[model samples]
Target: MNIGIDIEEIKRFQKLLKDKNFIELVFSRDEIEYCSSKKKNAVQHFAVRFAGKEAVWKAINKSKKLVITDISFKNSVLGKPEVYIKGKKASYIDISFSHNKTTVVAVAVSSK
Candidate 1:
């Protein structure tokens, strides 16, 4: 088992959101849609998701060819985050996210 964690300031993503290319490079379409749907809290959502992807990348420790967009997420019925990789559900990876008024954090545990 491998575990990874990441923390980031929500304000940083707020600034980064202005760059369309960065958004496209880092997040998947589904992630964009979900985060954008938050409207007022979109930046916080994006930051958390971004950190989630980072944590997942560290946990998997894959090659450099693995881009950030290769990891994605979908919220379950109870609003729990579920991890997906390369467009498929990654059952072996368990992830969670937490955030506050200014920061967001994510942790991933992989049984691979």
Candidate 2:
């Protein structure tokens, strides 16, 4: 099993979310839509998703050929975050995320 974690500041994440190019280049359609639906704490949600992606990448330890947007989140029936890279699935990956006033953190574990 490989584990990876990431953290992001809420204010910084909100700032980056305002940049269309950054969003377009770093997030998938579902991710953008998911954050849009959050409304109240969209930045926190987006940041967690971003952290999820980063942690997943680190766990996979793949080449840099994979971009940020290459990883995405999909909720399960219980609204649990599931990880996917490109169109491939990784059911073995476990994800956890949390946030507060200043920051959000996410951890991912990939067991082969």
Candidate 3:
């Protein structure tokens, strides 16, 4: 298994989402919905999704054809974040995310 993580300021993410194109570049409907259900603010959820996308990309590196939207998170019955790939059959993906007053962080793991 390979693991990767990324952390960035909330303000930076807010700026990026201001560009509609950038938002389109990084999020999926499921991810947006799940995150939105967890957090009241859309922008905060977007930041977490952005971090998850970066972490997934970093973990998969050059070996997979996954795009940003190809990675998504949904809530399990336990309300935990579950990560999955859209169109590829891979080993596994695990994601963790957190946010503070100023920053958001995400970590991902993938195995073959």
Candidate 4:
């Protein structure tokens, strides 16, 4: 089992979203919706997604081919966002995102 967690302030996310590629590199539709529902800024949501991707990469041993789209959120019965790694064996991933007026943070954990 491996775990990787990341957190960032909202202002940092605001600046990073200026890069179009960065936005496209992360964020699944469900994640965007989840962030939007939490009243987080679009850029902040994107940032969380980016952080989630990086955390997942780190947890999965940094596979170069693990693009953002390769990981997705499938809602559990409890409505939590369950992480899925495409075309792989059963694994576990946990992701969470939170934001205040000035900061946003994301955390991810994985199990082999």
Name the better of 3 and 4 by lDDT: 3
Pull out the clashing pairs in model 3.
none
lDDT of 1 by residue, 1-112 (tens): 8998999998888889999999998888889999999999999999999999999999997643567888999988898999998998999999999999999999999998
**Could you estimate the TM-score for every candidate?**
0.93, 0.92, 0.80, 0.66
lDDT of each: 0.91, 0.85, 0.76, 0.65
Total clashing pairs in model 3: 0
- What stretches of model 3 exceed 4 Å from their correct place? 36-40, 87-91
Candidate 4, residue 101: the lDDT equals 71
Q: What's model 3's TM-score?
A: 0.80
What is the Cα-based lDDT of residue 86 in candidate 2? Answer: 84
lDDT comparing candidate 4 with the true structure: 0.65
Candidate 4 residue-wise lDDT, 1-112, digit = tens: 6777767676777776677675555665666666557563676666666666666777775644676677766556886656777734234677776666776666777766
Residue pairs with backbone overlap in model 1? none
Residue 42 shift from truth in candidate 4, angstroms: 2.2
lDDT of 4 at 56: 71
How many clashes show up per model? 0, 0, 0, 0
RMSD of 2: 1.5
**TM-score, candidate number 1:** 0.93
